[model samples]
Target chain A: MSTNGFGNISIMTRSMAWLIVCFLVLPITIVFAVSVTDKHYLSLPEQGISFQYYEKLFTSGPWMTSILQSFVIACASTVAAVLLGTLCAIGCWRLGNRASDFVRMLMLVPIMVPTIVYALGIYQFWIDLRLLDSYTGLIIAHIVTGLPYVVITVSTALAGFDPRLEQASLSLGASIGQTLRLVIIPNIKPGVISGAIFAFIHSWDELVLALFIAGRAVFTLPRRMWDGINESLDPTMAAVAAVLIAITVSLLCTDAYTRSRRA
Target chain B: MAGLEISNVTKKYANFRAVDDVSISIKRGEFLTLLGPSGSGKTTLLMMIAGFVQADRGDLTLNGQTITHLPPEARNLGMVFQGYALFPHLSVFDNVAFPLKVRKQSREEIATKVRAALDLVQLTALADRLPRQLSGGQQQRVALARALVFQPHLLLLDEPLSALDKKLRAELQDELKRLHRKVGLGFIYVTHDQEEALSMSDRIAVMRSGKIVEHGTPTDLYERPNTAFVADFIGKSNFVSGSVVEHRDGGFVFSGGGVRFVQRTKGPAPAIGAGVSIALRPEKIGVLRSGETAENELAGTLTEWNYLGSEFRLVVDAGPFGSFSVSVPTWQSDLAPEIGAAMKLGWSAAAGMVVAQD
Candidate 1:
């Protein structure tokens, strides 16, 4: 009788976990199915599967341009964010006082505030600075939004790092910059890489800020996808979403592999 | 004049003084140890000397040059921190070669020097292994090698062996002493372990409450500690407090626990009727047999006893003086110690020393 009770509980938990996973993954699978639909509109294929939408997504000039623009912005903003955020985390970790703690908390405000609110706030500033509709403006805006991820990850890495290594380097005749480059940086490489990946994905998928500040001259991938959904229910948008899911999944897998190897 | 000099150094954290008004001059090739219990400012003093912690009021000179305001890199001191803070990402070879690389030494010189440093620690076979891959003792040797490779003016170690097991720590203690002899550079080591300090240091400075209570050679500090704290901290001691009653030729008579006894002092004698304390070692007192006598004797009942393989330890309860712990060698004692048996503990006049109460 006791064995039956334990077995029943285990079965219930296992079924519940599987149900939750299926509920979470069902929408992504639908998007993948719609991507290969044979129809011209947004419905699933009735007769046979088709590669027409995928081919169209590749061939279309606007789609290619938007993808390129988004890639450039993500790369630029990720570099800026990693550099600024890693330094900020290191400064906070080293200072280890109330003021630095307050500043570290302030870095997370961008992530905490609603994206629409941040977009409206930055839209006003971009207009005042006359930086609207430019690559520089979009890159800077994405960098501000991407910084918190980098700060959090790098700060966690620094928490586990032995502060004595820095002292040892300095005592061995290495200057402050030399210690950071040779000892500190190499030790925290995993955190920096994880931060860069998050920052890149953030800038790649961001649409609200691009919708607010970006104009005709600088259309990003998300902005183009948003326009496609509004102008027409095109299945090519489903193909774009599938491609985005693939890229994001692959990047996340690489990050997981790196972290596991480190462990 | 050609060694490190720290004068009137102090460090305060808010309301607390971590290291206060301390000064020490280390000779060129001396192995000095800052010995104390936890929170005794030994490590803080070492950090101040290493240029990691700034002194609130002091001057630090190295080889006749004032380096009080110099950064740690410019000060040119090597430090082996607690837990052997090796870079986890770098191999042993790269870790030891770091200082040479920082100075931009020729690649050939760096390789040869790194090889020699590894060879000194006898870790040449594992040069390519990361710090995580090495055992605790091996990692300690790597930290030592890295600190010595730069050939700094002085090497400071901050409780570097506290992380190891007892047997491993004992092994490294001998290794460190041999390395100190080989290098011939001044070493300033910090630790709370008294045995480690006594066994390895040329001179030991005992610290308490951010102050150096006494500093001397190992034997001097052990045999003639000036304070009750040092006597108790360095080794096991039984403190006996009394008031001086008379002055003798080379000693004084003190009435302690309703018993008068003579205590000799090489230093100035305490005034008559002044309260005083004496630190007596347990091993110095012996079990007096029939017809045997000593300068001081206390009769009591044996309340507890233990055989420690090499010696027999007995606690005797004297009526007025409370309990006196006496240790007798197993070979010297023919009678077995039984609890509640009458015993007479005896010691010579010089076995106890006058010590100041903390």
Candidate 2:
């Protein structure tokens, strides 16, 4: 009845919060229900449930191949993006003035622009370089888009780091390389892991860039799902979405476990 | 043989000089402290010795070898930073063993040395605990163990105990003194705390504005400070500026505050009417009896008084000479001090030292 107490939830506010949670979670739950439906068509089950779509997804030729292809592409892009972005972040942190600010802003350009506009220009350049529909082409495109996540996460980690640790290591008869490996890296490992996880997720779920850059040979999971939805409405697409969600949840769990241990 | 000599060291920033042609040295087993206030070049000189900041101009030699340009790792100096700088991710044992591990020591050697070092700090019980798991004092011990485990040529400490509480700081100060005596290695310590500097160091170098203003044994500096800055910085002092009255006797006479002061000077005698400043320690000034007189005496009122547990600090307002503080022992006092009580203060000529104004 009154607003005097701090954080006291009114019935209206409590219901509104639950409403937003359901609004976000209901669609994913429906897809999960449809993935295990006994029916072949894309519909949530009323009574009976079976994992026929998942069984088909594991055994089918195109589905398994697309999953494997996406896995390799996502891992490769994440590795490249995390390594490059971490180095860039360190260099920027070391430079630490107006110039590094300009460089950091430039690195964020890939996230600022709409992907659709740049997708057209990139596809044209890829055709000239004969890299269209290739794993390298798709992975490179994914890395560019994922770099900002890695850089932001790693930079935040570095920001919290104490530079005096590096100095102490140096004073204790450790060289520059030893200081970085022993003192600096261990202190910032949480940031690096989260950055890698974010970059991997960014690449794994990316669609527009993959849709334009990839074709038959390098069909990522997202690309195949896009094509499947356009051509046919099977319950297997729901199975694919469930698998993607499972992987994302696992990555997030890994991040949370590491951060909690750090604390 | 492993003594260090700093010859005319200098460091400059963009436009300002941080250390200006300062030179000091210590023997192999001496505990030398560079004491100063903030921005007084004490830490800057320590960093140069540790090779974190190179001296723009000067030569630093250890034993007989020049180490002016050596990198920090190659300099073989141990430093205890103010915040301890213990590795948060490493256990206490691992943190202490880091220097040995980097030096390519065998497993048995590292384990034995780390155990001994941890035992020295009395933290062997917490060897397996991470640095973050320990209290502030425990972490400081781990840092000391880490710095000492390597047996570097000399140890450099930059206000290492400044972060701890007063009780913990006193505890660690005792621990550090014991370690110094047991290990017998040269120590170059930097601190703005004059009390710590006086209590810990075998020799103290007082710094001011990028220079070593004075260097001597603590007692020597306390008794015979060369300048007003050193006198005021080292401890509390009552400064009285006066013109020399007469050089009739070997002792000099100066008249100020309507009080004639017979002063002692170790240097050459000043001419008559020449200006001089005298530093009188608070405890040295005394409460004269009704008829008794000393070499120097003044009459004033006890305007205010603070009753410290062990001593009473009395502020006497002497007209024309301004106010000066006098500390009297509580147990030996015969008179209970009351506010606005008229009193006579007196001290021997030897109690006041002639100091330069600058």
Candidate 3:
């Protein structure tokens, strides 16, 4: 190819890349921009920034408690999902039979089944267990919703590991338990970390399951946000949303950075 | 007493019998190689011995103790996989120390043994490096050091050198033999490379279709193969199909394609008019000049020639016998052979033997 042709191709590629970046980033940028508006109502860029709405959030609203509750719920639900999902993935990978396949599909039921249907069933089930409106019920619901992410991420990670490493460890006089702990878990570290991140984000941002299960005692961030937008038109909701976006962005950036380091 | 004894070992998966009834005894401190192509049950037999796979109708004994029902960990055997299987997250020192640490050795003991094992493989300086930090050959040495560090009673290697380049493979082949001697441990090495088996093994068991077709020392199998399969697999062999004509001088005279060839044998000579096959190694045949005399000579024309550095491999179109090959030492050649050049090929009767067709 000629130099002029190469130059033209390079310019075209650079513009195309920028187009894609803008397409993906524009909505999130707009969300952040709108969340910090000085106006009392949601709108475009404003003349100044103010902490009045944030102060109102702390003094008059239950937003702080809901944020703390969301953090607790996300942490508990993520831990539960990661433990169950890792074991399930390992079992399916080893057994590789119809029964394991059935288990895998069952675990993925929450993903394939519509959230409304799941919410209705879980709502009734929680009432029977006397867990409705309780933190335990909220945690269980989020765990069920987050389980599939853990399974998929861990399964993908385990796919790259050679089974011979396990065999080699066993042959070297390590028992099955030692082999799993020393060899299998170390090799699948990335997958487990990625899965934990996904599960955390899933639980943190989940709304429908919480709406069905958490009534009075358990008010998570998303639930409070839902009520806030419905009840009022204030700049404080924007500040809370801005904070949520920042947390989510930081978590996603950490995931991407760790994945790149592993690569 | 044998170091390891496998009696009538058989393995079946569904309808496919991966390892048919096979028995072999390996001696202590001897390097025995299971030589065969893929799906030939060599690896399956090794896995059975290593206690990774169960045998359907066999008992594996080590030092007169039956271990057919034992698990891999209980068997206390060292195994090197095809991929080396070095722990990527662990440093070379920790990798070699793992087996020892699993046995709950003291930290000072582990450190000493790990250093000594690394020195054996000449990887002492790389102890702190992770597996990925090392090159392929270095990773292979680390694997070997790990497998041998614990001084397990037996060692099993599954195509350990197959992952390396051809030249590196040859280099490691020598190191493996040297390690085998230094360690004085019974080693069951699995490979498909005929040259590796011939050079490193005290004995080789050649397998086909999940069965051992022949087993013997390198020279015994090469010069005196019991079957044509062994003859062809162990080395290059040109088979001549023919019928036995007469019994002569404790041997048999075979007539085929308008030529008569005599084969010396200690087994029952083939009946007259019975079909027979003769196995002739390419290197055993000599390209003869005019008036050159030998035990047997046949006239032929050179069809193609390949220069293999040390030797010239010529394909001669011998009538009736079809195209036969003769390897000529390049250093001894007075003149290079041209394509279509008429030549004479000769070999002693003892060089070509009557081998079983199967």
Candidate 4:
């Protein structure tokens, strides 16, 4: 007698969707529960609730430094990507359709190829340039990886933009620069912000490329977290994962909120 | 405040000439409507005048200053796009105030001007709403207000009312005319609707294949179109192609399909035996009753007819002379039409105008 909210979709597919949702949430839930466990080693929440691991998260110098470094790199790279990528998208949009499409595809090179391959290529290039393991090198690499996200989102934003709005502005005595700043930019801000969010997230949890390219000179949070996991089951690791999940969820929620605001 | 002269303006796109040596002298405070079907280059010509498009070879002078190479912003023209193109994010107030803000006007000046513009369009109460929050007609008014806020020298509208429903379109048509009169700004309006052009414009330029085939007052173009295209495009006209049999002071005789048609022309008459087409408006041709008489008359069978409320549009088939549409008022007590019934169609000699074949 009940339609199960799907209206016409079969019960099998509905249950499958719920099953997938649970499957996805289970690991995060377990890590979140483990993060609060009172035990010394990593274990489930059969023990008493403890703030000890979370306390360690804030107190540890090296862990805090890694987190701070990640934040700096992510902020720097997100800024660089959003600016360059948004401008690039505007350039492509002006170039007209076919050429714009080709340029857009070209911008996606970093995203299209395997990360390890591009990372290795970038490492060789940076090593030759003597920028290896430097903040500039890591930030540049992060920007290159993040560029595609900003380009795609801004391009998508520009897609719905009525070009006549620009014409209307120009005809009403605003220069091209004024039109972009006053009209085009604000309309596409949601896209640029979402792109920034993606770029930040991309740089924040980047381990593979950072692992190959960075060492002690630039010890990022993910790089340190990866090392901690490899070395030992530090209960602090569960706490870090829980924090990472929280940060990613918040970033995604912001993206969703902005996207819905746009709609 | 300004009169713009477009002299020999032309735009070529690869193999096609989008605007071909098109020239129109838009007088100060004139409401000129460029009426044409799609691909007739009315939009292209409008774009050229607005400085959005660079003419291949021409000179555009606004108040005697050559502005052919000027960018749109430098031209200081107002334009309303087909979709209204209101900024979705900005409120009606900000949208209307954008020009003043970009020019760095004082906050007080911007508020006053924007308020006046909104009030002009009757959208003062809804100034705080975004474009999406408004209905189609409201969005249109906002676009109008935004363009008019700057008090531009000339206003260019590109099929601005095409997006609205029929009733709203008629309402805005009056609104546009009232705004033009109130502001006294020169306006260049583009539309494909003949009725809209006829009712609203001081002068209508009927374009065909990248050229202004006819440019005149709506009544002038309607009554005396110089070309077959203009006659047909400006309004419904029944064209009869033939060779001139004789040329005279009052009327010229042209014969086609075993029927000799007499047409009136004020211009230089074509020589006898020259090919030409006569354009006759449907309303001009009346039903000749039993004793009624006209300058010219033809007998034909009514093949098709449509009841157009105020009048009946009958398609009369005159054998080899071809089918002609004749509009007869329903109130007139005369020959009532029935399918396949033979009837005599008549029009004065002045009703059929001699139009160029090309």
Best by lDDT: 1
Docking quality (DockQ) of candidate 1:
0.90
On residues B62-120, what C-alpha lDDT tens digit does candidate 4 reach at each position?
98899999998998888899898888889989999998998999999999999888888
**Candidate 3 TM-score for chain A:** 0.90
Query: lDDT per prediction?
Result: 0.93, 0.90, 0.88, 0.90
After superposing candidate 1, which stretches have Cα over 4 Å from the reference?
A1-9
Q: What DockQ, between 0 and 1, does each candidate earn? A: 0.90, 0.82, 0.78, 0.86
Question: Each prediction's Cα RMSD?
Answer: 2.3, 2.5, 2.7, 2.1
What is the C-alpha lDDT profile of model 3 across B244-319, one tens digit per residue?
9999887888888888887877778889999999899998889877778777678888999999999999999988
Q: Taking the tens digit of each residue's C-alpha lDDT, what string does model 1 give over B1-358?
A: 8999989999999989999899989999999999998999999999989888999998999999999889999988889999888999899999999999999999999999999999999999999999999999999999999999988999999999999999999999999999999999999999999999999999999998898999999999889989999998998788888999999988999998888888998977899999999999899998899899999988999999999999998888988777887788898789677889998888888999899987
By DockQ, the candidates rank as 1, 4, 2, 3
True lDDT of residue A151, candidate 4: 99
CA shift at A73, candidate 4, in angstroms? 0.9
List runs of model 4 lying over 4 Å from the truth: A1-5, B246-249, B264-269
lDDT of 1 by residue, A49-161 (tens): 99899999999999999999999999999999999999999999989999999999999999999999999999999999999999999999999999999999999989889
TM-score of each: 0.97, 0.95, 0.93, 0.95
- Candidate closer to the true structure by lDDT (higher is better), 1 or 3: 1
C-alpha displacement of B78 in model 3, angstroms? 0.8
User: Worst 10-residue stretch by lDDT in candidate 4 chain B?
Assistant: B328-337
Model no. 2, DockQ = 0.82
lDDT of 4 by residue, A1-263 (tens): 65686588888999999999999889789998899988878898674798789899999999999999999999999999999999999989877779888999999999999999999999889888888888888999999999999999999999988888888888888888898899899989999999999999999999878988899889999999899988988899999999999999999999999999887
